[model samples]
Target chain A: MPHATGKITARELIDLQSHLMLESTLVGQFNHFARESTDPQFGQLCQKLAHSRTDCLQRLAQHTNITPIQ
Target chain B: MYQDQVTDKNLCLAVINQLKWSATCLTGKILECEDEQLRQDYMQLLNRTFAEQKEAFDLAHQRGWYQPMMADQQMIGQVQSDTQKLMMEQQQSMSPMHQMAQYQGIQAPQGLNNYQQSFTNPNLQNQSIYVGGGQPYYSR
Candidate 1:
Protein backbone atom coordinates (compact mmCIF):
# COMPACT_ATOMS: atom_id res chain seq x y z
CA MET A 1 0.00 0.00 0.00
CA PRO A 2 1.17 3.52 -0.74
CA HIS A 3 2.25 5.46 2.30
CA ALA A 4 2.24 2.07 3.90
CA THR A 5 1.84 2.08 7.66
CA GLY A 6 0.05 5.35 6.95
CA LYS A 7 3.28 7.17 7.51
CA ILE A 8 4.40 9.55 4.80
CA THR A 9 7.83 11.06 4.93
CA ALA A 10 8.34 14.79 5.07
CA ARG A 11 10.21 14.64 1.79
CA GLU A 12 7.33 12.99 -0.01
CA LEU A 13 4.82 15.40 1.44
CA ILE A 14 6.90 18.42 0.49
CA ASP A 15 7.56 17.03 -2.96
CA LEU A 16 3.87 16.62 -3.52
CA GLN A 17 3.03 20.07 -2.21
CA SER A 18 5.72 21.73 -4.30
CA HIS A 19 4.52 20.02 -7.44
CA LEU A 20 0.98 21.12 -6.67
CA MET A 21 2.00 24.75 -6.32
CA LEU A 22 4.21 24.60 -9.40
CA GLU A 23 1.46 23.27 -11.62
CA SER A 24 -1.08 25.66 -10.17
CA THR A 25 1.18 28.61 -10.92
CA LEU A 26 2.00 27.31 -14.38
CA VAL A 27 -1.68 27.16 -15.23
CA GLY A 28 -2.03 30.82 -14.38
CA GLN A 29 1.07 31.85 -16.35
CA PHE A 30 -0.03 29.90 -19.39
CA ASN A 31 -3.43 31.53 -19.34
CA HIS A 32 -2.01 34.99 -18.80
CA PHE A 33 0.27 34.62 -21.83
CA ALA A 34 -2.50 33.16 -23.91
CA ARG A 35 -4.69 36.15 -23.10
CA GLU A 36 -2.06 38.56 -24.40
CA SER A 37 -1.34 36.56 -27.56
CA THR A 38 -2.76 37.65 -30.93
CA ASP A 39 -2.68 34.30 -32.65
CA PRO A 40 -5.62 32.02 -31.93
CA GLN A 41 -3.06 29.31 -32.39
CA PHE A 42 -1.03 30.68 -29.47
CA GLY A 43 -4.16 30.57 -27.38
CA GLN A 44 -4.60 26.96 -28.38
CA LEU A 45 -1.05 26.27 -27.29
CA CYS A 46 -1.69 27.76 -23.90
CA GLN A 47 -4.88 25.77 -23.64
CA LYS A 48 -2.87 22.62 -24.07
CA LEU A 49 -0.33 23.65 -21.41
CA ALA A 50 -2.98 24.59 -18.86
CA HIS A 51 -4.86 21.37 -19.46
CA SER A 52 -1.68 19.41 -19.00
CA ARG A 53 -0.91 21.11 -15.71
CA THR A 54 -4.46 20.67 -14.49
CA ASP A 55 -4.27 16.97 -15.13
CA CYS A 56 -1.03 16.77 -13.15
CA LEU A 57 -2.59 18.67 -10.30
CA GLN A 58 -5.61 16.38 -10.21
CA ARG A 59 -3.43 13.34 -10.20
CA LEU A 60 -1.37 14.80 -7.36
CA ALA A 61 -4.55 15.54 -5.46
CA GLN A 62 -5.64 11.95 -5.86
CA HIS A 63 -2.30 10.66 -4.66
CA THR A 64 -2.43 12.82 -1.55
CA ASN A 65 -6.10 12.14 -0.93
CA ILE A 66 -6.89 15.77 -0.42
CA THR A 67 -8.71 18.31 -2.48
CA PRO A 68 -6.48 21.35 -2.94
CA ILE A 69 -7.46 23.96 -0.40
CA GLN A 70 -8.47 27.06 -2.28
CA MET B 1 10.70 10.43 -4.32
CA TYR B 2 11.85 13.97 -5.10
CA GLN B 3 14.29 14.68 -7.91
CA ASP B 4 16.62 16.75 -5.72
CA GLN B 5 18.28 16.61 -2.34
CA VAL B 6 17.17 20.00 -1.16
CA THR B 7 15.11 20.61 1.95
CA ASP B 8 11.36 20.81 1.50
CA LYS B 9 11.25 24.45 2.50
CA ASN B 10 14.00 25.32 0.05
CA LEU B 11 12.27 23.46 -2.73
CA CYS B 12 8.99 25.18 -2.02
CA LEU B 13 10.68 28.56 -2.08
CA ALA B 14 12.45 27.84 -5.33
CA VAL B 15 9.33 26.57 -6.99
CA ILE B 16 7.21 29.48 -5.77
CA ASN B 17 9.81 31.99 -6.97
CA GLN B 18 9.94 30.43 -10.43
CA LEU B 19 6.17 30.36 -10.61
CA LYS B 20 6.05 34.02 -9.70
CA TRP B 21 8.51 34.81 -12.48
CA SER B 22 6.54 32.83 -15.00
CA ALA B 23 3.38 34.68 -14.03
CA THR B 24 5.15 38.00 -14.38
CA CYS B 25 6.36 37.19 -17.86
CA LEU B 26 2.91 36.04 -18.87
CA THR B 27 1.38 39.23 -17.53
CA GLY B 28 3.65 41.18 -19.85
CA LYS B 29 2.56 39.01 -22.77
CA ILE B 30 -1.10 39.47 -21.89
CA LEU B 31 -0.73 43.24 -21.88
CA GLU B 32 0.88 43.25 -25.34
CA CYS B 33 -1.81 41.18 -27.06
CA GLU B 34 -4.52 42.77 -29.21
CA ASP B 35 -6.36 39.60 -30.19
CA GLU B 36 -9.71 39.28 -28.48
CA GLN B 37 -10.07 35.54 -28.76
CA LEU B 38 -6.50 35.00 -27.64
CA ARG B 39 -6.94 37.45 -24.79
CA GLN B 40 -10.09 35.70 -23.71
CA ASP B 41 -8.35 32.37 -23.75
CA TYR B 42 -5.45 33.69 -21.70
CA MET B 43 -7.85 35.38 -19.33
CA GLN B 44 -9.63 32.11 -18.71
CA LEU B 45 -6.34 30.36 -18.13
CA LEU B 46 -5.16 33.06 -15.73
CA ASN B 47 -8.41 32.85 -13.80
CA ARG B 48 -8.11 29.11 -13.37
CA THR B 49 -4.41 29.35 -12.59
CA PHE B 50 -4.84 32.09 -10.00
CA ALA B 51 -7.38 29.98 -8.18
CA GLU B 52 -5.20 26.92 -8.14
CA GLN B 53 -2.12 28.86 -7.07
CA LYS B 54 -4.08 30.36 -4.19
CA GLU B 55 -4.77 26.89 -2.91
CA ALA B 56 -1.13 25.93 -3.17
CA PHE B 57 -0.04 29.06 -1.36
CA ASP B 58 -2.48 28.48 1.45
CA LEU B 59 -1.30 24.93 1.86
CA ALA B 60 2.33 25.99 1.98
CA HIS B 61 1.69 28.66 4.53
CA GLN B 62 -0.38 26.30 6.61
CA ARG B 63 2.39 23.73 6.74
CA GLY B 64 5.01 26.24 7.88
CA TRP B 65 6.71 25.79 4.57
CA TYR B 66 6.26 29.48 3.84
CA GLN B 67 5.36 32.56 5.85
CA PRO B 68 5.09 35.67 3.75
CA MET B 69 5.45 38.82 5.80
CA MET B 70 2.23 40.24 7.16
CA ALA B 71 0.79 43.06 5.08
CA ASP B 72 1.70 46.68 5.61
CA GLN B 73 -1.69 48.28 5.39
CA GLN B 74 -0.32 51.77 4.68
CA MET B 75 1.57 50.69 1.57
CA ILE B 76 -1.24 48.44 0.48
CA GLY B 77 -3.81 51.17 0.83
CA GLN B 78 -1.65 53.59 -1.09
CA VAL B 79 -1.19 51.16 -3.93
CA GLN B 80 -4.88 50.36 -4.02
CA SER B 81 -5.81 54.01 -4.05
CA ASP B 82 -3.33 54.75 -6.82
CA THR B 83 -4.69 51.93 -8.92
CA GLN B 84 -8.23 53.13 -8.37
CA LYS B 85 -7.23 56.60 -9.37
CA LEU B 86 -5.64 55.34 -12.52
CA MET B 87 -8.69 53.29 -13.34
CA MET B 88 -10.85 56.36 -12.87
CA GLU B 89 -8.61 58.57 -15.01
CA GLN B 90 -8.69 56.13 -17.90
CA GLN B 91 -12.05 54.46 -18.03
CA GLN B 92 -11.19 53.02 -21.43
CA SER B 93 -7.68 51.97 -20.49
CA MET B 94 -6.34 49.31 -22.84
CA SER B 95 -3.53 48.39 -20.51
CA PRO B 96 -3.15 45.48 -18.14
CA MET B 97 -3.06 48.13 -15.45
CA HIS B 98 -6.82 48.21 -15.84
CA GLN B 99 -7.08 44.47 -15.60
CA MET B 100 -4.83 44.52 -12.55
CA ALA B 101 -7.08 47.06 -10.92
CA GLN B 102 -9.90 44.57 -11.27
CA TYR B 103 -7.99 41.74 -9.66
CA GLN B 104 -8.86 40.81 -6.07
CA GLY B 105 -7.06 42.54 -3.22
CA ILE B 106 -5.16 39.76 -1.51
CA GLN B 107 -2.65 41.74 0.50
CA ALA B 108 -5.15 42.06 3.33
CA PRO B 109 -5.96 39.12 5.50
CA GLN B 110 -9.46 37.64 5.32
CA GLY B 111 -10.25 34.57 3.19
CA LEU B 112 -7.35 32.22 3.89
CA ASN B 113 -6.93 33.39 7.48
CA ASN B 114 -10.37 32.07 8.28
CA TYR B 115 -9.09 28.48 8.09
CA GLN B 116 -5.40 29.07 8.71
CA GLN B 117 -5.65 29.03 12.49
CA SER B 118 -6.98 25.51 12.31
CA PHE B 119 -3.99 24.25 10.41
CA THR B 120 -1.61 25.84 12.88
CA ASN B 121 -3.41 24.79 15.98
CA PRO B 122 -1.52 21.90 17.53
CA ASN B 123 -4.66 20.15 18.66
CA LEU B 124 -6.12 20.38 15.21
CA GLN B 125 -3.03 18.95 13.59
CA ASN B 126 -4.19 15.40 14.20
CA GLN B 127 -7.26 16.14 12.15
CA SER B 128 -5.80 18.44 9.52
CA ILE B 129 -2.07 18.27 8.80
CA TYR B 130 -0.97 14.81 9.84
CA VAL B 131 -2.92 11.65 9.28
CA GLY B 132 -2.28 8.20 10.81
CA GLY B 133 1.33 8.81 11.84
CA GLY B 134 2.92 11.32 9.45
CA GLN B 135 0.93 10.55 6.34
CA PRO B 136 0.30 13.92 4.75
CA TYR B 137 -3.32 14.78 3.97
CA TYR B 138 -3.32 18.60 3.51
CA SER B 139 -7.01 18.58 4.42
CA ARG B 140 -8.87 21.73 3.59
Candidate 2:
Protein backbone atom coordinates (compact mmCIF):
# COMPACT_ATOMS: atom_id res chain seq x y z
CA MET A 1 0.00 0.00 0.00
CA PRO A 2 2.50 2.57 -1.09
CA HIS A 3 0.71 5.93 -1.13
CA ALA A 4 1.47 8.68 -3.61
CA THR A 5 4.08 11.24 -2.60
CA GLY A 6 5.21 12.94 -5.81
CA LYS A 7 5.20 10.24 -8.49
CA ILE A 8 2.31 7.85 -9.26
CA THR A 9 -0.12 7.79 -6.35
CA ALA A 10 -2.50 4.98 -5.40
CA ARG A 11 -5.30 7.21 -6.67
CA GLU A 12 -3.67 7.30 -10.11
CA LEU A 13 -3.36 3.53 -10.05
CA ILE A 14 -7.06 3.35 -9.27
CA ASP A 15 -7.75 5.71 -12.16
CA LEU A 16 -5.68 3.54 -14.49
CA GLN A 17 -7.63 0.54 -13.27
CA SER A 18 -10.86 2.40 -13.94
CA HIS A 19 -9.73 3.22 -17.48
CA LEU A 20 -8.84 -0.40 -18.14
CA MET A 21 -12.23 -1.45 -16.81
CA LEU A 22 -13.87 0.95 -19.24
CA GLU A 23 -11.75 -0.42 -22.08
CA SER A 24 -12.86 -3.95 -21.21
CA THR A 25 -16.48 -2.81 -21.28
CA LEU A 26 -15.95 -1.12 -24.64
CA VAL A 27 -14.33 -4.25 -26.02
CA GLY A 28 -17.34 -6.31 -24.95
CA GLN A 29 -19.59 -3.81 -26.69
CA PHE A 30 -17.45 -4.06 -29.82
CA ASN A 31 -17.67 -7.84 -29.73
CA HIS A 32 -21.43 -7.60 -29.63
CA PHE A 33 -21.32 -5.08 -32.49
CA ALA A 34 -19.08 -7.37 -34.50
CA ARG A 35 -21.53 -10.23 -34.02
CA GLU A 36 -24.38 -8.13 -35.38
CA SER A 37 -22.34 -6.45 -38.16
CA THR A 38 -23.08 -7.64 -41.73
CA ASP A 39 -19.94 -6.12 -43.26
CA PRO A 40 -16.99 -8.52 -43.06
CA GLN A 41 -14.36 -5.74 -42.83
CA PHE A 42 -16.06 -4.01 -39.92
CA GLY A 43 -16.60 -7.36 -38.19
CA GLN A 44 -12.94 -8.29 -38.70
CA LEU A 45 -11.81 -4.92 -37.30
CA CYS A 46 -14.02 -5.37 -34.26
CA GLN A 47 -12.70 -8.91 -33.66
CA LYS A 48 -9.12 -7.61 -33.92
CA LEU A 49 -9.96 -4.83 -31.47
CA ALA A 50 -11.50 -7.31 -29.08
CA HIS A 51 -8.33 -9.41 -29.16
CA SER A 52 -6.20 -6.31 -28.55
CA ARG A 53 -8.43 -5.43 -25.61
CA THR A 54 -8.03 -8.94 -24.18
CA ASP A 55 -4.26 -8.43 -24.27
CA CYS A 56 -4.69 -5.07 -22.54
CA LEU A 57 -6.90 -6.67 -19.90
CA GLN A 58 -4.23 -9.27 -19.21
CA ARG A 59 -1.57 -6.57 -18.83
CA LEU A 60 -3.86 -4.58 -16.53
CA ALA A 61 -4.52 -7.68 -14.44
CA GLN A 62 -0.76 -8.19 -14.01
CA HIS A 63 -0.34 -4.57 -12.89
CA THR A 64 -3.24 -4.47 -10.41
CA ASN A 65 -3.14 -8.09 -9.11
CA ILE A 66 -6.94 -8.11 -9.30
CA THR A 67 -9.25 -9.91 -11.70
CA PRO A 68 -11.72 -7.92 -13.76
CA ILE A 69 -15.31 -8.34 -12.63
CA GLN A 70 -16.54 -9.38 -16.07
CA MET B 1 5.64 9.51 -36.74
CA TYR B 2 5.74 13.32 -36.48
CA GLN B 3 1.97 13.46 -36.67
CA ASP B 4 1.73 10.84 -33.93
CA GLN B 5 3.80 12.95 -31.55
CA VAL B 6 1.65 16.01 -32.23
CA THR B 7 -1.51 13.99 -31.68
CA ASP B 8 -0.15 12.58 -28.43
CA LYS B 9 0.83 16.02 -27.16
CA ASN B 10 -2.60 17.39 -28.03
CA LEU B 11 -4.30 14.46 -26.28
CA CYS B 12 -2.09 14.90 -23.22
CA LEU B 13 -2.87 18.59 -23.11
CA ALA B 14 -6.59 17.91 -23.41
CA VAL B 15 -6.44 15.38 -20.58
CA ILE B 16 -4.44 17.75 -18.41
CA ASN B 17 -6.87 20.62 -18.98
CA GLN B 18 -9.86 18.38 -18.33
CA LEU B 19 -8.31 17.18 -15.06
CA LYS B 20 -7.60 20.75 -14.02
CA TRP B 21 -11.20 21.79 -14.68
CA SER B 22 -12.52 18.72 -12.85
CA ALA B 23 -10.31 19.52 -9.87
CA THR B 24 -11.71 23.04 -9.75
CA CYS B 25 -15.27 21.72 -9.92
CA LEU B 26 -14.57 19.17 -7.19
CA THR B 27 -12.97 21.80 -4.96
CA GLY B 28 -16.09 23.94 -5.21
CA LYS B 29 -18.34 20.94 -4.63
CA ILE B 30 -16.26 19.91 -1.63
CA LEU B 31 -16.79 23.30 -0.04
CA GLU B 32 -20.56 23.00 -0.49
CA CYS B 33 -20.82 19.31 0.43
CA GLU B 34 -22.76 18.76 3.66
CA ASP B 35 -22.05 15.05 4.16
CA GLU B 36 -18.63 14.29 5.59
CA GLN B 37 -18.19 11.20 3.40
CA LEU B 38 -19.17 13.12 0.26
CA ARG B 39 -16.70 15.87 1.14
CA GLN B 40 -13.96 13.29 1.58
CA ASP B 41 -14.84 11.73 -1.78
CA TYR B 42 -14.60 15.13 -3.50
CA MET B 43 -11.26 15.81 -1.82
CA GLN B 44 -9.96 12.43 -3.04
CA LEU B 45 -11.04 13.30 -6.59
CA LEU B 46 -9.30 16.66 -6.31
CA ASN B 47 -6.11 14.99 -5.09
CA ARG B 48 -6.29 12.55 -8.03
CA THR B 49 -6.57 15.43 -10.50
CA PHE B 50 -3.62 17.15 -8.88
CA ALA B 51 -1.60 13.96 -9.30
CA GLU B 52 -2.65 13.70 -12.97
CA GLN B 53 -1.58 17.32 -13.59
CA LYS B 54 1.78 16.58 -12.03
CA GLU B 55 2.16 13.57 -14.35
CA ALA B 56 1.22 15.60 -17.44
CA PHE B 57 3.67 18.31 -16.40
CA ASP B 58 6.40 15.71 -16.03
CA LEU B 59 5.69 14.29 -19.49
CA ALA B 60 5.77 17.78 -21.01
CA HIS B 61 9.03 18.53 -19.23
CA GLN B 62 10.52 15.28 -20.53
CA ARG B 63 9.65 16.31 -24.11
CA GLY B 64 11.28 19.77 -23.47
CA TRP B 65 7.98 21.47 -24.28
CA TYR B 66 7.77 23.12 -20.83
CA GLN B 67 9.50 23.10 -17.48
CA PRO B 68 7.73 23.28 -14.13
CA MET B 69 9.08 24.97 -11.04
CA MET B 70 10.27 22.38 -8.55
CA ALA B 71 8.16 22.00 -5.43
CA ASP B 72 9.68 22.24 -1.96
CA GLN B 73 10.60 18.73 -0.81
CA GLN B 74 9.77 19.56 2.81
CA MET B 75 6.28 20.76 1.87
CA ILE B 76 5.64 17.54 -0.07
CA GLY B 77 6.75 15.45 2.88
CA GLN B 78 4.33 17.35 5.16
CA VAL B 79 1.45 16.75 2.75
CA GLN B 80 2.24 13.03 2.47
CA SER B 81 2.34 12.66 6.24
CA ASP B 82 -0.96 14.53 6.61
CA THR B 83 -2.63 12.32 3.98
CA GLN B 84 -1.38 9.14 5.68
CA LYS B 85 -2.66 10.39 9.03
CA LEU B 86 -6.07 11.13 7.54
CA MET B 87 -6.27 7.67 5.94
CA MET B 88 -5.39 6.03 9.25
CA GLU B 89 -8.02 8.10 11.05
CA GLN B 90 -10.63 7.07 8.48
CA GLN B 91 -9.73 3.37 8.97
CA GLN B 92 -10.01 3.81 12.75
CA SER B 93 -13.54 5.19 12.39
CA MET B 94 -14.89 1.85 11.13
CA SER B 95 -17.20 0.10 13.62
CA PRO B 96 -16.34 -3.20 15.32
CA MET B 97 -18.89 -4.98 13.15
CA HIS B 98 -17.22 -3.65 10.05
CA GLN B 99 -13.83 -4.66 11.44
CA MET B 100 -15.13 -8.21 11.98
CA ALA B 101 -16.40 -8.30 8.40
CA GLN B 102 -12.95 -7.25 7.19
CA TYR B 103 -11.38 -9.97 9.32
CA GLN B 104 -13.78 -12.55 7.88
CA GLY B 105 -12.77 -11.49 4.38
CA ILE B 106 -9.12 -12.13 5.23
CA GLN B 107 -9.84 -15.52 6.79
CA ALA B 108 -12.08 -16.83 4.05
CA PRO B 109 -9.68 -18.71 1.79
CA GLN B 110 -10.58 -21.65 -0.48
CA GLY B 111 -9.72 -25.19 0.70
CA LEU B 112 -8.25 -24.09 4.04
CA ASN B 113 -11.32 -23.72 6.20
CA ASN B 114 -10.19 -26.00 8.98
CA TYR B 115 -6.65 -24.68 8.99
CA GLN B 116 -7.92 -21.08 8.99
CA GLN B 117 -10.38 -21.82 11.79
CA SER B 118 -7.63 -23.36 13.96
CA PHE B 119 -5.47 -20.21 13.76
CA THR B 120 -8.16 -17.53 13.70
CA ASN B 121 -10.01 -18.57 16.86
CA PRO B 122 -9.33 -16.42 19.93
CA ASN B 123 -8.48 -19.35 22.21
CA LEU B 124 -5.48 -20.41 20.03
CA GLN B 125 -3.46 -17.29 20.92
CA ASN B 126 -1.38 -19.19 23.48
CA GLN B 127 -0.57 -22.06 21.12
CA SER B 128 2.03 -21.48 18.41
CA ILE B 129 0.39 -21.77 15.00
CA TYR B 130 3.59 -22.41 13.08
CA VAL B 131 5.35 -25.75 13.48
CA GLY B 132 9.01 -24.70 13.95
CA GLY B 133 9.92 -21.35 12.37
CA GLY B 134 8.26 -19.27 15.14
CA GLN B 135 6.76 -17.12 12.42
CA PRO B 136 3.21 -15.84 12.80
CA TYR B 137 0.48 -17.72 10.94
CA TYR B 138 -0.51 -14.60 9.00
CA SER B 139 2.09 -12.95 6.77
CA ARG B 140 0.62 -9.53 7.29
RMSD of each: 26.6, 20.7
Docking quality category of candidate 1 according to DockQ thresholds: incorrect
Pairs of residues at least 3 apart in sequence or in different chains that clash in candidate 2: none
Q: Score the docking of each candidate (DockQ).
A: 0.03, 0.02
Please provide, for model 1 over B1-140, each residue's C-alpha lDDT reduced to its tens digit, 9 standing for 90 to 100: 76455444444454356556545544654575444433454455456556645554664676687887887999899999999999977876665764554442322234544455455756554443323222334563
Model 2 chain B: lowest-lDDT 10 consecutive positions: B127-136
Q: Name the lDDT of candidate 2.
A: 0.55
The local lDDT score (0 to 100) that residue A46 gets in candidate 1 is: 54
Off by over 4 Å in 2: A1-70, B1-6, B67-140
Least accurate stretch of 10 residues (summed lDDT) in model 1 chain A? A1-10
Interface RMSD of each: 20.0, 13.0
lDDT of each: 0.55, 0.55
